[model samples]
Target chain A: MFYAWPFATLLGRVLQPSSVVDTLTSPGIGRVIWFTCWQALVSTALTMAIGFAPAYVVARYRFRGRRAALAIITVPFMLPTVVVGAAFLALLPERWHGTAAAVVVAHVFFNVAVVVRLVGAMWAVLPTDLTAVARTLGASPARVLRHVVLPLLRPALYAAASVVFIFTFTSFGAVKLLGGPSHPTIEVEIARRATQLGDIDAAAVLSIAQLIVLAVVVWWSARWQRRSEHTFAAGRTTRRPRTRSERRVVAVVMATTVAAMVAPIAMMVARSFRTSSGWSLTPWRTLGANEVRPGISLGVDPLGSLAVSLRYAALATAISIVFGGLAALTIASARRHGRLLDTGLLLPLGTSAVTIGLGMLITFDTAPFDWRSAWWLPPIGHALVAIPFVVRSLLPTLRSISADQRLAAVTLGASPLRAWWEVEVRRLPGPLLSAAGFAAAISLGEFGATTFLTRSGRDSMPIAIDRLLGRAGAVPHAQAFALATMLFVLTAAVVAIADRQEVVDARRA
Target chain B: MLDVRDVSLSFGGPPVLQRAALQVPTGDVVALLGPSGAGKSSLLRVIAGLLVPDSGSVWLDGSDVTHVPPHQRRIGLMFQNEQLFPHLDVAANIGFGLRMQRTDRATIASTVEELLAVVGLHGFGPRRVTHLSGGEAKRVALARALAPRPAVLLLDEPLTGLDRELHDRLALDLAGILRATATTAVLVTHDHDEAATIADRTVVLGADMT
Candidate 1:
């Protein structure tokens, strides 16, 4: 409901039912879609192939430093795409930056974390005795995996595959930063049509098509997740690798999974400190200065952008928490009707980020609702996307507070509002803090939509990095890397603080 | 003969099984009687080659098979949890071992059909294993373990969770199946009556024994 006014109005204004066919069937549009499909397919296939071994190892093995290994694998996925793409650019040769291979490599790093977490958690609850039974029945280790483990894991695999496909298909920030003119995606096409070409008709048609495909993938993924979670009960404890070969396999897996993830991020942070003559922290020391290097005058200041990003993050965090908490309470209080609201709230997730960005840009710029110059406009857009995530992360904990607990308070000489305060308010700080931190982190690194909303003087950190990377010379690139590192650290610090707070609250509760 | 010699094992703490040894002559059944967590299941895994012990060797027919993989040992194990493949139907689950052995489809089908009847589920070949009752799942697990006709079979508390009437009925059926095939077997259980009913000899694995 938050974005419905803008989206419906913009669609009504720009999308003519008659011209939808003419625009969708236009020549060269097929190439945009073909590139989208093949790249998504290739990225999903590569992610699944590279991610399965590590996922299985993490799920089924008990070893020292397992949590640390998992955190290393997970950190890349948490960082903003602009940061991730900038890191890739620093790691790869400049000539390879815009090629399809670079795009696929970036997508792999971006989506691999999803595969590891999703499939690993699914495989954890699967009964290990099934594999043991198969072994005793004369099946070799490979045969047992082929016939038994694969079948059991099919649902989760499909779910993860579809999710990766959807995200890759409509991906904007990574594609915008990494994809050059030769490899254009449908998402980039929509952004171009809406912003640069003055062709709202074409943009509307493309976004609608993208929206349909995304909705379908989202629906299918939900079905697979339901089936996967429903089919099996948790059983059997995971054990440390007991044999020589088992321990060797675990060691090799650890080295590969952790090393593959940490290298690019480490290189990005380290490269920012290097100069033509020697290693210096000039970029780090001078990043906040209006003029970064002696000879260059880059208009966008990294320091100023940092302040802008923090302001927007604070506003977005406040908006999402208040609205998301109320939404979760409504959903929990009204179970039957809440299912519909639950699906509706998650619609923003299924919708393309490019489409949402365009919708906000257009709807506010027009006459009747011209809030385009307002300082909080971009944050409002950020909050629109952040609320769904907040609601999702907070729903389970909200539901865990049973109605009986509230009723028990009510029966003991407390009014209904007082009862809510006594029960939910007392237990809300942990989950609420985590949710707010998540919203803040998202706004800090949000690249896809922020790319569109950066026409204002105030630029977010991701936009600053993108503009810096686009400019030539070593200083600009160094500043981009420096800013990327700062963004990375800020996002990581927020996540770590939230995680620590939750653990502390968990112990207290 | 199936023999386990001085199998000692621990999980980085107190030993769960220490200096445990057992020998079963061909065509005879032995029961390892112990309470829960007495390491009877761990010892059975060691003999089946699913787990390697700290100090032990498993011998089958005068050949050391301790370091061999479980698939090559020809020792069938029916898990206490009856870990039936939820994805496979009854006949496919029963025929899994034969398929692994590369038996012809005709032979696999005949063996699966006959074994389903032996376990009193003759018409259950097409049914999903996930829908089976607890007792039925155990019967299918037993049938699947027996389908390849292992030289020796291991049952790990196979009837522990079933109700009294079903347990008694399944015990009789299990004993009849074992004797009729003349299968060399070892069964582990915490129930004294179950141990007496299913084996020719009973050995104790207690805390003090470990």
Candidate 2:
């Protein structure tokens, strides 16, 4: 439903010979495409550069509060883009807001966590002995890094860069807020053409172009990452910093990462409480009031929007849990096409959410199936982007159960289903809860499709935040910041609790 | 020459190696025999500069290298499981040590070819390490350890996992290679036949033995 219907709708329009030439010839479209590629490249480079030291520190050294630091850094990756936009808006001076620099910074804030996680996971497993062996052969530390460590980490680096690139390339909400008027990405351009200009053909052409690029990048990254995906037996036995310089590096990296991740959200929270005289809770207290901004009346009640978002997230969680769990089970048992099915499941994550929204708009607007006004449409849209997370989280945990355990159960007179239930399902609550937490987090902060489907007064949390930030009043801005802080705390708490539970389970196991 | 003095070590339990001392003259192969959990591998790790002893020092050629990092110690260790680099082919694995020393491409190629020949795997250089049989992989690992030509080579149960016939064959090959290189070496093993076949002298390590 996510990729097929969207591509089919896009191809229907793109197949026209005039559409391609028209989209390519439009000077504005050409510029949007160029700027999108340039920013994505630069943002991916910056994210990789900023994330490397921290990832190395986390993976190679054991320090006090290291695990907590990892969990905290991951919060930004799960945050709503509008919240991140609000964070930068609150943190940066007025002169720096709504610029290309702001957009790039926000992109880095959102994506650096990905590089840290992917590269750090790989860096941890790599036996320290390989480098030790190289050193014994007269290689210096720098030489060992170049000849031994870099070659080994190249695949993970490629994968991280690819994911960050795709994310920045398809960015919408942050680009909408932080990019101002002069800088529009392909996704931003697609949203404008589809919603504002009603230029469906141009949107379709751009969607196709973005999908083609995304597919190629994802495929190449997967090819490289597959080489590094071996089951590592030797666990990460981290040690404390052994030298003064080592201690300094760890301190600096950890300090910078914590500040970079935390300060923006902190500023947002602070801004929520700031009034003309001093800090107060007036903005939060007025969440239920419909405030007027100059001549315009903003009718949204922040609490109502929060409730709507919670309901949508709950519905999305249910849908994804059922579908993703069944998909994981099928893939685990499948002897053929499993890889293809896995890739298919992940296609929605790589494709632009704007394209999927437009696809749903056009495809579901006719006869008895007019879901344009349905409350369930947004949750379904959220599910399309969320099921992959569910499957990815559950599939690995499910696959990790050795088949011998099930075989042993069956040999003791249990049926196959009963054996699987006893050996696998009994061990699944931890991962399933983690998957649900991830799905709920994604649903709560989902903005791209919600922006398309939501009505003015019945907006979800992210859409409401985006709308609040768009208006011209201190009240709207404060409400947006307060709401963003709320979303941040909610999502962070979910993800942190999930991670903590997983860690506790790991210790027990 | 290698010397280990009073190298007692433990992991918060009963000592694995207590007041252990050994000396090997230049160009001699000495085997340390012990049962499982008898600290034979732990002792080898200490000598190879991978582990630091609690109250002893290690000397190589009359210089105390106890505090030297493993890489700077110039000691070669082939693990019991034959820890070949899975990402590299047989040829690259054999030449990994030389490459780390920044040896030129031509010399690395020749040295890898020679080592492969020494291990009787000349034609198998291009094969993936993962594709190799267990015995073949062990040979590649041996070649990699020998390629650096370190001062002291430590072999930890290099023949333990092989079949009986292959073990006997590789023991003879290993003996010939040691004699040909005149390499100062320490072999850790529990099998008495393996120790007798590979070493000039044997040292037994156990709670009852001093």
Best by lDDT: 1
For candidate 2, the per-residue lDDT at B48 reads: 79
Taken over the whole model, the C-alpha lDDT of each candidate is 0.86, 0.85
Model 2: lDDT equals 0.85
lDDT, candidate 2, B63-106, per-residue tens: 99998987778899887777666667889888888887778999
> Stretches of candidate 1 above 4 Å error?
A13-18, A225-230, A292-296, A505-509, B35-37, B206-210
The alpha-carbon deviation from the true structure for residue B125 of candidate 2, after best TM-score superposition, in angstroms, is: 2.4
Sliding window of 10 residues with minimal summed lDDT for model 2 chain A:
A228-237
For model 2, residues A36-94, the per-residue Cα lDDT tens digits are 99999999999999999998998899989997898778889988888898999999999
Evaluated against the true chain A, what TM-score does chain A of model 1 have?
Answer: 0.95
TM-score chain B for all models.
0.96, 0.96
What is every candidate's C-alpha DockQ against the true complex, given to 2 decimals?
Answer: 0.73, 0.32
